[model samples]
Target: MFIFQAAAPGTSIIRRDLGAEPLPQTEALYAVALASPATLAAPPMGSLNLSEALIREVEAADVIVIGTPMHNLTIPSVLKAWIDQILRVGRTMKSTPSGKVGMLRDRPVYIGVASGGFFTGERANQPDFLTPYLSLALSSIGLKTQQFLTLQGPPHWIGARHR
Candidate 1:
């Protein structure tokens, strides 16, 4: 499954130029499940429509790829909304005596985050909220493997690469 966040200006190029695919929501989930046959079913999450379906996608996927662009030194609103949909109480995560226990496990998450400025400690930019927040959020659901590829500035970080 792929989470594409291109709400930021100039990032629409990810689709036209980079040839990326976006994840489907709601009833589309039914189509994919029917086409590919899976043991996934929507869980109880109040009146939310996509929450259960999105969780199933994450759980079924062996690897998750997220494409996002930093906005205002953080993740965009669309991505945040998607996160809210996926992260549900007693479903993706649960409260325990130790703390909150993540339900889903044994999956790798790959995040592609593009930014206009460098985010490493030595860079002029401040600490990146995108990576840390995503780490915590996804970790809460036991999907912990993550890789971030950030492209900074118009020239596109020609000098250095994030490792």
Candidate 2:
């Protein structure tokens, strides 16, 4: 399991700016045999100069975990930046006549999201651009198996919970 941490908890600007309580300094991950038959390795992936380590981690992780806060009804810029690093053209995927095809092996992605407003279920009141966008983005890399865990309520509910 790899905690694809876009921002270290200690320096997570979103959490700080949102006034959320400090995240746990030490986090642990356990992995189960999350597998798929996706083993198509045709388009060789290029390792981004700076993101090579991140790409390696993604390849190694059987289960990937990302914890993020939805900002402005979508993902924070930090998370977006991280995604840009991993979404390599020749590396993670390749362009085909039909469309883009992913070359990396598939894995389970679990996303934990914190939102200031309710966007789904009966209490839905706001437009939800987060989940759909993430679903599309992640699926592009062959990470089709995904689950979202959301915690929504009043603004700063995340902070209050930790405190």
Candidate 3:
């Protein structure tokens, strides 16, 4: 699985625990995958146009995992930047005369969210942009995403256990 951790320092800790290598941010990664022979072989995909470099990463991996610490009620800009790259038109996805068609086959995406407060429903303790937006956006592009595995510290979610 390719882990896209929005938190850098904490992300390294998580990566070490999981025994997985984190993928580089999209730009540096772009050139490696877009090498001459590979691009030449696949004309249907013109991923060179995307500067965000996320498309190459996503296409290369069979599974994707995202680790994030909720900040100010939203996802970090770094992760959002990656999303911008992968959601390219006529590349990872396309709009056609018929309708929107996702070129990517279905892949599983696991989201690891660490938050100080609870925000599962309408009665949100804090504004949350992680769960819903991630679910929707990933679904839009043929990724099967799941609700977060929320690791809430002792202050919250410690007393309750859901079935």
Candidate 4:
């Protein structure tokens, strides 16, 4: 896989399997809203909270690599939940008079996508909401530099017919 190939001498890799791990709960949004001010003022340390854990991961990473399959033209709900947990106001971004501004320093993000059906160029029949949405989300968190690699074909041709 891409991660394995990307791994080399002096490179550190941190992997989070969203499907296997217990994602943040819906209540996490409320918790963030309540803790935003305090967190912004003095960031927590040694916290075991899931949201905090995810935030720390993003903060520590130099380059983020995500590999995912297209599901109904968008990312899975679990990934969306992870996004909600990480995109904390005052922590990842701030609301200014002009608009929301990202606080974290920009970094490069590489997204590998696999699709059963074509979603790019003139042959595309399905609308691609994933790329644009993810771009905006990452940018909101100050990760503006992004590279996307996609493999598109028929379900059977791509050996994804089981899905």
Best of the candidates, TM-score: 4
Query: Where does candidate 1 clash, by residue pair?
Result: none
Q: Is candidate 1 or candidate 4 better by lDDT?
A: 4
lDDT of candidate 2 over 1-163, digit per residue (tens): 2223443433221222212443222111100111112322221233224355667878877677778888999988767766766676566877679777887898988888887778887777789899999988888888989999888877656554321
lDDT tens digits, residue span 65-101, model 3: 6778677677766667666667655566666787556
Alpha carbon RMSD to native, model 1: 10.3
The TM-score between candidate 1 and the true structure equals: 0.66
Please report the candidate that would top lDDT against the real structure: 4
Assess candidate 3 and give its TM-score to the true structure: 0.59
Better of 2 and 3 by lDDT: 2
Candidate 2 deviant stretches above 4 angstroms:
1-47, 155-163
**lDDT over C-alpha atoms for residue 163 of model 4:** 23
Model 4, TM vs. native: 0.80
- To one decimal, what is the Cα RMSD in angstroms of model 3 from the true structure? 9.0
What lDDT tens digits, residue by residue, belong to model 1 across residues 56-136?
767766656777788888887667766766776566877678876788885776777777777874664667777888888
Clashes of each: 0, 2, 0, 0
> Distance from true position, residue 92, model 3, in Å?
1.0
